[model samples]
Target chain A: MAYPLPVANVRLKNLTKQFDGVTAVDGVDLDVADREFMILLGPSGCGKSTLLRMIAGLEDPTEGEVYIGETMVNDVLPKDRDVAMVFQSYALYPHKTVQANIEFPLKVRKVDKVERAKSALAAAESLGLGEYMSRKPGALSGGQRQRVALARAIVRKPAVFCMDEPLSNLDAKLRGETRAELIALHQRLESTFIYVTHDQVEAMTMGNRIAVMSRGKIEQVGTPQDVYDRPASVFIAQFVGTPPMNILPAGSIETGKHLVGVRPEHVHISPEGSLAMTVTLVEQLGHELLVTGRVGERRVVVRQPAHSVVPEIGAEVRIVADAADLHRFDPVTELRIDI
Target chain B: MAIDQIRGGRKIGRYVLLVVMAAIVLFPIYVMVIGALKPGNKVLVNPLLPSNVTFSTITRAWRSGHLARALVNSSIVALVVTTAQVITSVMAAYAFVFLKFPGRTVVFVLFLATLLVPLEATLTVNRRTMQSLGWLNSYKGLTVPFLATAFGIFMIRQVFLTIPKEMREAASMDGLGHIGFLREVAVPLSRPTIGALALFAFLTSWNQYLWPVLITTNSDYNTVQTGIAALQRASLSQPNLVIAGTVIIALPIFVVLISFQRQLVRGLTAGAVKG
Candidate 1:
């Protein structure tokens, strides 16, 4: 390539999308820095995919604008936006050989054959797909087809990469390896990447900044640690963790709020604790234990290291939470109340 | 041992059934070939057998029927119709599936409603339209009315709908718009259905008897099908010539079906099967 593609930050201003009479994405405002890996984390129908599609120009927004670099691209055609997408289905041109698939973006750009072949080969070699260049997508395994899609995305070196759950189709092991590969690719290219997925593990592991969304609205946006440590809303507090945060009525501890939350790992069992709970179930992981029980009418989970003394089912235990670990929320708004 | 015996007996039964079916289907072809090969005087003597294999009747039928010109005209019409239909169907199908507009559903429904009106029902009106356009007795009369087909639109549309919507979006992000996506992705993936559609368009155009009979007054534009019918009437005294003409008329279809057997089957069963 004669010149490397310029890295561009992405901005969404009051972006909204509606289908029929119902809103799919409602008033989303975001800024993705150049070279930042931003993950849109939400459940299905939370409109993460719809938001990404708006930025890619695949969906027309019902209101507001999208800016790539300094250009307001709400009206720009997707092809002219200089963005590349990797679909979840891999969506490889099933009829084209892998080599041709990687060469397609360049071919569409009217890059000469000699240069197209050279860049395609370079991409294939980087992805360890040199051996499968002549094979059609159907002949390759799921993992290999995904690599071909990545090769195709990178061959042209677009300013932004919009991937819609690109690793969801791969098996658990293959997804892990591909995730590492993507991180390395991001570092090497230094271009903005907008990834959408419902998996929190992917969001926590891969994104420099995570936007947690629910019901067509962004609940909060922050770095992984920030969102995990101090969620802005009760939805983020519950949605981003395995077994999630245990939310209960703020009882008698003088918390001065209607509701309080604590992550499972933050709730611990000790003899001198304030709350008493009856253990109802036990989940034994090799490295830790998750004990589920009730404090009054509200159920909560406590994560304990394997070396710690564990509680048996049908036994009573005292649970404690450090004041620093307690998250207070306004019950009516479900938004965090900074205490 | 008992299981093996049951399996062996079933296999034999299947072979017997297949042979009977094959014989039943091939009987008409056998009669046509044998009748064509027999001499005019001996045609009724041993209709089941090749009594005297001769080329004289076939040659005379070819010349008298003017089948060479008929074959050329039919080929031109079928080829033109098939190519035009495929291109038009693909474009229309793409529009229906990918493009968004007001009244899209109503328009698609109206387009599909044409499929319910049998070709016979529209023949008279279409013929009148062609006549008013000065297309009578010309290749335009034979090919123009058939340049686009509703059945083709329906089949290709069904195939196009199966494509993941994300593929189009992905192509857009890759700097290829709708036209590029249709060329590089949609058409290639739908090759089987398109092949089937082409075979069908060619077959339907080639075998048209009523349309050609109504459209062409000049013998120069007579298709093989009309030429074969003319042979039957002119050779009332020479039955062998008529039989030979019938065989000649059937040869091209047989060649086409044999060469594109896969596509023909796929086309006929296009909506019933997934690619």
Candidate 2:
């Protein structure tokens, strides 16, 4: 059977970056298929953003090569890279009107008046910045400014789009709306997107393939399901989930398995399975209950489904999960178990 | 009532201070006008007002000093210098701020260091240079040395630093090289500072007296300041025309100042804070 061709496969081979006396991105290799929404998720000071900037050609890697499609763009200037970036700052020119800011790139490229307007209009409409065209960025609301920023990036019609925490500057509700819109927008455009964020929830929701990076090194790269269900390392397990994965010591239960990873949503109250524990505290989130307690010497969190009776603070409860669903890891190496 | 009285006392105190400062600042100008308006004989009397001022005294000063031609010459010089200074400074500032060329920072620092050297110090050397080029008394000689002022470049560079790097990056991403990006992106966004700098440049050029007097021996190319000074000598016989010429010279600059007061204040504040 013939398989559909990937849109643009990006391959980075042994990528390394250094600044001043310090190394930032260290020996990372990755391949992202065309139309893939790949997220580099990490904590602050992690080199994930630096790696994205290298991909955007804003920074040059000290060693190795980066391939976008089949082109090795190691020394290529940022402008000719045919990629656009949205900054965490939103980086909107404060003085220019929304229309002018969005039209800026097109204008520089000498994209004629009619075509520039049409592209800007199309981008603005989709991003919901249509009515505020003539208003300066300083006058617009944060959400509107963000939309204008997004429109400015999209109007370029680039082959690749790199966003460094584009939703981070927004409030919670607007971030959610913009996130959903971004996903939809990505689907409609069918362009390759490399999103860098520290927020795992954003990584989980938006990325098809998630690369968990820690301290300038990529811990794991996999499909969201693969990474979430079978995290390559303890870092990936803990980094890819909301409220994070609960990594508790299994302690000789399984050989080479010093820790077993459990998602909060997957760990349940069964009263008979796994081990018995007394709930020290409970948090009700309308849709779920977060039961925190001690299982052996390990602190475990179990998510009870909504509408379930809330367990008392001191009540004894049993945290349950299938051994098959458990992701086991070595505490020393923090690498995933094959079993 | 006591609180109201205290507030009223402070308000009155502030008004008194302001009025005193204004009078102190404007008194010299008032003196010059009175001196220019009185006949040479009445000048010794030096009355504060123009009560007994004669039109004939003013007319004799106009004829004797040839102030009309000097006024025209001054306007042209100021206009030319202002345009040249603004354009050159903007280009130099843009290059320093945005482009990466060999020796750029060194060049910029050298340019900025010139701000410490007084404009008068350069007058002798510039006049020699002008004479060598056979440009003495020409408009080119009048305006050339004043171009590319350090103040204009420094002020523009201040505003340029505040602009988003992303805009510059975005512009570059669209195949806009240095000059292209400056014109297409940076310049348009910097309009307010440009207007502010333009006013500053105009003021500097229009008020310049020493260089114009030193360089241009021919009376045809004399600027407002030099022309007015020469007018003072002729109007020793008649003060009215001299006062009128002083008013004429001061009017344009005063109007320019009043209309752009906010911009001027911002420019001054921007300069002080930036340094």
Candidate 3:
């Protein structure tokens, strides 16, 4: 079975959603190119899920226009929008078998039974769920249930796929494996994928571009490396990394009226460095060490290779980053300063 | 060794208590069955015993009481009322739980307020309305007043609230309208509660005595309860006949309760434990 490539792009212009007086998604503008895998990444309460729901037509926007390809769909129903969504809960029918769950969308469209079964079987086999077709979701493992949800979403071959943290329920090992499978699926399906999650690793790995959101607004939209190397704002720099960027007072580094930002990997202990701090904790992460220290009133962490000499707790150490590796941000606006 | 002996004593004591309770509850039923089997003359002689066993009394009561037709009529009324109650309750519960309308809470409160009004208070008005509609001695009058119950709505609504909102949204995304979702998803997921409700409605409708006696005057429309009453009045000297009639009427209720016992327990305890 050959999958048809989608030619539709999703464009959101000044989309806003308010619940009773609290604005959930406020004045957000974004465009997902045809066949592009775009991830909406944010912390909890940041409106990433709400924005995804609005795009899926499960939610009505209080204001703004949503365009799929060339048609604006503000008043369009969810089914008529030609978009499928995979929920965080999976939302598979508990009473239905895996085969029936996959066939439900097709069944609702009045597709004949034979064609429905054929399509459902193909989708199930594609997801390695062929042997589990007769099982209900309650009997399946979390990863299998998540796969069943994916198969259901793909069975219809909608133009745009909206995923709301679909892999959050899986264990760590299975999450990694399924994350790779999802990337492969995006490539094979060749459809626009708009995924929402707070896990920066997922956004960095699977998305062609990540839209970093904060407090109901888009902070930055860029590639994984772009957001990492050159975060547009203080929030992006702190949010996009594992230990997060080390934000320090300007006087701690070079003389400037702005704050300094440095990645954990770039901060190192050196005898000749300028900034001095007391090492409070050291965590050995098998292949690396996370050294946390306190400078004045702020805490900073430095990631060092396991082979490096281990620092002693309560020992005073000087940390430094090369001038070229430093990022500057305005203390007032919190926006990045290029110079 | 000491602990084992104490545990054994406690277990034996528990079984003894359970047996005593069981005997107490079943004593009346045992007497009824024994009296139903004995002839009218021997009913007062050793009423606790099962001697002089015979089916003649039950057979005689069946013929003289017109109970076969009464059983058929009661079955029809109960089945119709049960089916209608289940459907009406599910639809009303769905509206209460899923639909957005103005004054929804107020309307639900009003529906609940109907439950507070005792059935006796509405009996006079209901009979008058039935009379005006010329439905006396008909199945319509026997079943229409109970087709939709506020208690049914409230019980079903509690079960329906357990269905996550995501299921409805998922159904919507699958292109299912309200009716389609209700039929394919809502109704099926709520089977246990509906089953329990159906059994309850059937038993309630079957056991009705006052309303059926008041509204029904024709012997053709005699229900099991009314038929049993008439049998008691006609055979005052032969009290065993009425006992036989009661034993027969209880057979269907027993079968229904046995078959639906699992659903009743599960549905009654649905939300007590959260997954």
Candidate 4:
């Protein structure tokens, strides 16, 4: 990176936040390395956003401490925390021109006019918003407004960037485009990026590591492949993959006291397999066919190539998965177990 | 074809109804202008028709009513009141909307409760306070009592609530303090409502009749409203003179309303739709 940004790692220790009597973010501890793009991934109401807000200093934690680099910043104001945030709503100043919105941070810090204009122009141009500099946020499209928000966050070149589902408002196609742009921006700035999202695809594609959360708790933190392949718990195993992992009762496949877990892609139909299922439905998703069926009383989905022969509804079929692809979780604890 | 004819007939009926309503509203202004143009003796005769037109009546009324001075006095008071009310209202509304404090809702309710108390109810007490402070018959007396209104605060706050909470958070993250955010974001975003408030404040202060009559004894301190009363009292024989005085005094308000018509509509209709 050519720019000199004050890159710093973020560390949270025993952080907790409660709204009224309900706990939104429970005691949690995590560390993000310098310039690492860490993602907080979860379902809605899972407290990933609350956790991100605590780190950004927008929301105060009820307990514990937040560390930026080596300094404890629990008492510091958001302005002094050296972190910029891109909100889900974009939150660009509606009255300010795109150029002025980008320059707002510098303007508040009393930067000189010439330097502010230069930096604003450079930021806008980098975001491909050079022509819309004079336009208000109301005049720009949703994706362009999101980019302007990104430009505003980057203009000051803070140590850490906090994005709370910044691309959620954009259409799917635009979201994909901005996802790539954000990755490149993170690389170019060489700054710590902590992103919060409920989309698993975004977590897998954009994050260097994903912290999966549920019920105000971090279930597991690992790389996308690690979390997908060797999830620490059944919750993470189901949450990190499309169509989720199928969980069958104990002893459904082999004699065991644990539940069996297998990914939809790993489940296959075979003529000589052991488990028998009745086909219920099939969804053709262009390149893949999602075959849903009932194995005993549990519904299971299997991913097959689009070219495969479609099974008739209510027809019996044998299903099988390799032992290596199977995951075992204790039925009572819901935690993974090794043979 | 029958339906089209019926629709056309209904449209013409609506136009006719609108014309009648407009005429009813404009009749008084028409009478006033016609009355002002005629000599005092001819005013009562053929009041609806303009005849023996004389511009001298307006000039005479201006001189005898001390209208030039009155207009200046009214302008100063209205402008000062408008500016002060806008500042106070915006600051108060921002605090009520954004700042966290104890008893915030109770305090805001108490503030709004003042709106139910009519100005006439507090007139005597306010007059005594102004007199004790020696603001009577002065610009201070005219403008100070109405510098801030609860209605203005409530109106502006309604508009302010429409601003997303994320905007304030974003501003804070960008290093803007409360004042910075209010000045740079909140105020500019609420400009239409503020403009409407300013117009309302100016008109209210400009047309103040009872307050100005109660506080001021000196003709030198007379506002346009009080000056018009004085003109009527002095020119009992020349009724047109008083009418001309009113016509002159109303010009500024008409101009203000016409110029701010767009803002007024937008501001009034604000909060009617959820953004």
Give the number of the best model, judged by DockQ: 4
Candidate 1 CA-lDDT value: 0.90
Clashing pairs in 1: none
Error of 4 at A39 (Å): 0.6
Clashing residue pairs, backbone N/CA/C < 3 A, model 3: none
TM-score (2 decimals) of chain A in model 1: 0.97
Per-residue C-alpha lDDT of model 3 across residues A1-339, encoded as one tens digit per residue: 448855589999999999999999999999999999999999999999999999999899999999999999999999999999999999999999999999999999999999999999998888899999999999999999999999999999899999999999998999999999999999889999999999999999999999999999999999999999999999999999999999998788889889999999999999988999899999999999999999898889999999888889999999989999999999999999998
lDDT for each residue of candidate 3 in B22-135, tens digit (9 for 90 to 100): 999999989999999998899899999899999998999999999999999999999999999999999999999999999999999999999999999999999999999999
Give a tens-digit lDDT track for model 2, residues B23-79: 999997888777666766676584676656756655665565676787677677778
State the lDDT at B185 in candidate 2: 65
- The local lDDT score (0 to 100) that residue B161 gets in candidate 1 is 94
Score chain A of each prediction against the true chain A by TM-score and list the results: 0.97, 0.92, 0.99, 0.99
Clashing pairs in 2: A8-A34, A79-B173, B36-B239, B36-B240, B37-B239, B37-B240, B58-B241
For residues A182-294, write the lDDT of model 4, one tens digit per residue: 99998888889999999999999999999999999999999999999988888898888999999999999878889999999999999988899999999999999999999
Task: Tell me the deviation in Å of residue A36 in model 4.
Answer: 0.7
DockQ (Cα-based) for each candidate: 0.76, 0.49, 0.86, 0.90
DockQ of 4: 0.90
Q: Mark the 10 consecutive residues where model 2 chain A has the least summed lDDT.
A: A1-10
Residue A136 in candidate 1, Cα distance off native in Å: 1.0
Question: lDDT tens digits, residues B65-108, model 1?
Answer: 99999999999999999999999999999999999888988988
